[model samples]
Target: MPNVTIYTTMMCPYCFRAKKLLTQKGVKFDEIDVGTDPGLRREMTTRSNGGQTVPQIFIGKRHVGGCDELFALEARGELDAALQAA
Candidate 1:
């Protein structure tokens, strides 16, 4: 499996929903709580092409955008392949 990372905030429902979906899919991830750390939040912004919002997800080195984008990808049957790809 590729390295999965998610930049999230504690009170974001989208963040929680994203996590629930990943967990249901059995995808392990490294979560960075940007709400609690200003440095990490900036890092998230830089890594996300200026998207400072919560739930910026990366599968391996690929930026997968936010929760809605993720669901859209899943709906298109692309997310799993991207996640499982080498």
Candidate 2:
């Protein structure tokens, strides 16, 4: 399984939706609550290439952007392959 991580705020609806989608897809992830951790938030920003938004997602160290980007990947039939690849 890929090492998935998601940086999120407690009250972000997109964050919730992103997590829900990942769960529904049976994708296990490490969730970091950046709203409560400034250091992690800073790290997430760096990881996301300066995307200072909630729900910065990664799959095995590959920056995957946020909710809309995730959905876009799914729409393009790329998400599954990405998840399954080494």
Q: Could you tally the backbone clashes for each prediction?
A: 0, 0
Task: For candidate 1, write residues 1-49 as lDDT tens digits.
Answer: 8999999999999999999989999999999999988899989999999
Tell me the spans in candidate 1 whose CA falls farther than 4 Å from its real position.
none
Instruction: Give the Cα lDDT of each candidate.
Output: 0.94, 0.91
Model 2: per-residue Cα lDDT over 1-86, one tens digit each:
78899999999999999999899999999999989878988999988889899889998978999999998999999999889978
RMSD, every candidate, angstroms: 0.6, 0.8
Roughly what TM-score does model 2 have, to 2 decimal places? 0.95
